[model samples]
Target: MENKVNRNIPDEILASYDYQPFTSTDIEGMPVERVLPTFKATTGSNKLVDSLADLVNKTVRDGMTISFHHHFREGDYVFNKVMRIIIDNGYQNLTLAPSSLTNVMNDIVVEAIEKGVVTNITSSGMRGTLGDAVSHGALANPVIFRSHGNRARAIETGAIKIDVAFLGVPNADEMGNANGMDGDSAFGSLGYALMDAQYAQTVVLITDTLKPYPNTPASIKQTQVDYVVKVDAVGDPEKIGSGATRFTKDPKELKIAEMVNNVITHSPYFKDGFSFQTGTGGAALAVTRFLRQAMLDNQIKASFALGGITKPTVDLLEEGLIGRLMDVQDFDKGAAESMHKNRNQQEIDASWYADAANKGAMVDKLDVVILSALEIDTKFNVNVMSGSDGVIRGAIGGHQDAATAKLTIISAPLVRGRIATVVRDVTTVVTPGESIDVLVTEVGIAINPLRQDLLAALSNVPGVPVFTIDELQQMAEKKVGTPKPLEFTDRVVALIEYRDGTIMDVIREVKD
Candidate 1:
């Protein structure tokens, strides 16, 4: 059943589209201002609901789309509480559009699907049992997986309109001014939820701590909100960073980090006013340590550091090594605290961070960005969405968006125990080969041939060895041997869309 004709098109062509200016109008040609009535009241005197059942009965209805944010990471409780209420109320044809679905959300979502309470889902990613269930045709319709930027664009352009946004804030005022900075459940940078506050037809601020009116430095402005509901507790703050941020104690990971720092220092963009973004993993965090010492030696200071804010990145800002910290999300408690105190630590929504349709975003200003990869191909294409077994286990979060930087550096070990990081091709191409500028492993650095300027610039750098990407791939294969081919079902579990909304790749679920 293999097709003969070539349907694959060039990425540039796929990304090219006429830039049409947007007006304030809905899809049906009515003025958006008229369609969505603005709330004029300064405050609502409705008594706070005691339970989720009461909240759902007051806000949720049949065939409506509700949304939640994933700032609490693995410790999120609001999503489950809200979904259970909707299920108990017998609501059907509901679309669950959370920012992302973690392992904890899988069980309840499956039950909701079984009860016919939930049918459609759109999110940045899904993992664990929920992904497995969806892949097995658990629902009649396919799930739509979008990038963080694309989701923001979808909401603003009226493609995926939200009926209600149930925001879980750490601190809020009785008048609906809220932020993720001040209470027991504090999680910094209410970046993702800021978009929901602006676009959702109705926004309910659900918080564990409710302060008095006139909450200053409001992350969620009171003008955009319609209601405020207080709860017993939103989430456990200790679990906010959970698995997202960690310092590596593994020797192998440290070796990879050292190699990554060597690659960065030897690159052309290592001079003053350079910009970069790093992940919150063990090895990735170690890279920052190396980079910090290198910067001190070379007398270089970065203009700004961008992405999900980690405590290490925030430390750079505090130490005057980086001029600004442009944060779209916070990864740890230290970062969450810094956002509250530092005036230079600016909080921005996802659209301003990476949306391609926007006039200009922070990604466009990046000089270099250090990223992680689940699997990389000889072609330099990356797979951050699927695992070696073809299962949906990872997220697309800012990976492709930051790949558009002037220098995109991916730091990963060549192999992890038995699995090779460098394969013939990736399972899912979240980032195309053209966008990746350099690949660094523990053994050596590989400069993309397309980036001849970088290869020429780093030719004589001391203490660094450069090699062809193919040579590194061969070395890894020689050590670990080629991995067995993964078996996948024919059904498409998720569609990977580029920032421009084109189908970059499609991932099929792994066979059980």
Candidate 2:
């Protein structure tokens, strides 16, 4: 079946999952029927478990769905620790439903798949060896890739019912109250884990640092928790943002960042009190740096900033350049530490951050958003999922959710090492072009024809070169030549879901 994005999703696959193909991008938010979670009744003060091995034995069952969070990013240790116990305990056919999978989990997840411990899997995205394994059909079922927002929506609507949620906290009490903003392994807000804590059938809180009985200001409350377990360490804080999202010194990246700032300032959305979201990466983080100066020079202040919190963004919040930081996940240690002292840095759960079913999602209120893409087509559709070689190497993240902003700018280079970043068509469409507004590359910028108002507005901005999407594609092809078409078998490996809970595209297994 061909979706609205024109991607052919196999009918058999759709029937297996009972999911609808991408119909329209204009789907509106409706009142959601929240799925009631099954909870075991227990009245006791002794909710603490001595070890993960004991916890897994008590909570995990064969063919059950289990979940975890990626707040610790690449530094996460809880996942491997829990999975080892489950595999050793001889569990099989369990569904792995984490908020997202980080590379640190690659080896174990692959092993689990091979051993039939995790026969089913779903998450926001995957990369490295795990991605390679999934692409080659390592798991029994095709992996379901949902955006963060969609993951929250799936949980809320019971599309993904988790039997156990193994949440790793930085600080937790014996009674199960916990928070991720304290202790040595603190990685930031417990945004991704909140939904699981509330909706999972059994919520087990794991931590290295056990706080006092009450543990006030708990991000994961005692009422939501079923058990608590103390470990040696939850994760290493330093690698939380892949060793902190640092400032870029690359000249090409900086130039692209400057162009992105120019687009924001010249556009109608850049004003005294506008809201915006920006992704991570050398160029994307640099936009925050460039936007900071623009905000200072124009005497403009952003009303609020959204998405993964970064240190540069925290600097803006502390310096009063931005009024509030609505953080779902913190990207760096500085951002995580700032939340401890700054009241303005509010912690938000995944659903509240970007759930499509939530009418008042933070993403819908954005005036502008700066995003990154692996490749963008002439139609402006963005592919942040699979790379040029038809291998999964990236995540969808907020690319689709954040595209709902008034002006969504995609900042990417024209070519990356003889591979054109701009193509006639993306290898896969993660975010449809209709939602995109502008494409900012180092060589030039291209406004989506759908956004003619922006084109009229930015056409004459001095030093900001304007070009058609076709021209940018031409320049890319001129530099790198046309890329070879990827060959794939009919077997679907993964489903690229839109934030609205519809199938946007399906990735087939690459032919050997």
Candidate 3:
């Protein structure tokens, strides 16, 4: 059946899950009351555990749902180490629930699914071999894909109840008080894990460094933690940021960034005390640099910068161009290290960052946000979850959540290699068109007709040509002729959830 976005959802899958397909309404299945997990009041000064095996054996059982956080990104070690223990114990019908999955987890996740240890899965996205395996119907159940805020909301409302949560931190005390801003393996705010720690029935903290009693400014408090374990290494901080924080040198990317800057600087939101967020990618990161110069020239100072913290964004914060940095997750070691030194760089939980039910998420207050897209349609719908080959390779991350900003700008090249970034219709509509305002490519800028006010505001952005989204789509199709459609089987492999806990779309198994 076709949803409001015109994406087809299998009727059988919808009936089985009792899910409502995506529509224009913001909250399709909005939960009325917030759920608070029952916690045991125990008098324990120290909550230290000896090993991962002991931690898993004590907390895990058959058919239980377990959760984890991916703040470490690709450098994570706790996921594999703990999953191996759970698999060795021969746990069956266990549900794997993580904030998201990175390349480091692909092999162990595949092994567990093959071993029947993990029968169900839910996360932000899948990648590499694991995505391939899921695409071919390797697991017994379809994965439930959630945005970062959606996962937080799900856990809080018992929609995706987590029996056991294994969270890794950079440093922790013997009593389970922890923070991600300290020690050698520091990767930044424990934002995603904060929800897991608070709501999970059994919370486990895995750390590489054991600090003294009362680890100051604990992001993960002792009251929320059930146990703590020390390991050789939790993750590598350097690799977590890697290529994402680098400045772009390519002319196409620079042109896109420049176009985005022109759109922002000329728009109504570029005044003093404006707030913004720069989503990940070379072009998105480069927007911070261009925006910085524009802010300087206009004598503007932003009230705060929100979303994933990065080096370029931190530079602005340090230079006093932005007043506050609401750090939900840090993308680079520089931003992670900055958290230790900068008082203005505040650590926030996922719920506080983007949960729609929270009423006051940072995204709601955002003035401008620069995001990237794998594919976009004339309607301004975005597809960042899948590729032209119909394979899952990207995460929803904060794409849907951050799109709630006053002015949401998508920065991307017209095409990538042979795949057209702008398509007739997105393979998946992760973020609907209403939230997106402008599309800035190297070729030109397109303001959604839905926002005639913005179109009028940005009518004559100097040196930046403007056109209709249809014109951009035609140019893209002109360069690379009409592409063949992707083939998919009847079986649904995953359910893509909107930030409000509604079914945005479904990913069926790719046809062989």
Task: State each model's C-alpha RMSD to the native.
Answer: 5.2, 1.2, 1.5
**Lowest lDDT 10-residue stretch of candidate 3:** 23-32
Candidate 2: tens digits of C-alpha lDDT, residues 1-512: 88887888888878877878887667674558888797668889878888789778988889999999999898998999999999888899999999999999999999999999999888989999999999887888889898898899999999999999999999999988888899998877889899999899999999999888899789999999899999998897767765566789999999999999999999999999999898888998999999999999999999999999898899999899999999999988888898889999999999899889866789879999999999999988899999888988888887788898899999999999988999998988999998999999998899998877998999999878999999999988998876678898888888889888888998888887
TM-score of each: 0.90, 0.98, 0.97
Error of 1 at 77 (Å): 1.3
What is the C-alpha lDDT profile of model 1 across 364-451, one tens digit per residue? 8898888889888888888887877777777888887888888888988888788788877787777777779888787767888989
Which regions in candidate 2 have their CA more than 4 angstroms from the true location? 29-31, 242-245
What does candidate 3's lDDT look like per residue over 298-330, in tens digits?
899999999888888988999999999999999
Backbone clash pairs for candidate 3 read: none
Each prediction's Cα lDDT score?
0.79, 0.90, 0.88
lDDT of 1: 0.79
Tell me which of candidates 1 and 3 scores higher on lDDT.
Answer: 3
**Model 1 weakest 10-residue run by lDDT:** 18-27
- The predicted structure with the larger TM-score, 1 or 2, is 2
Best by TM-score: 2
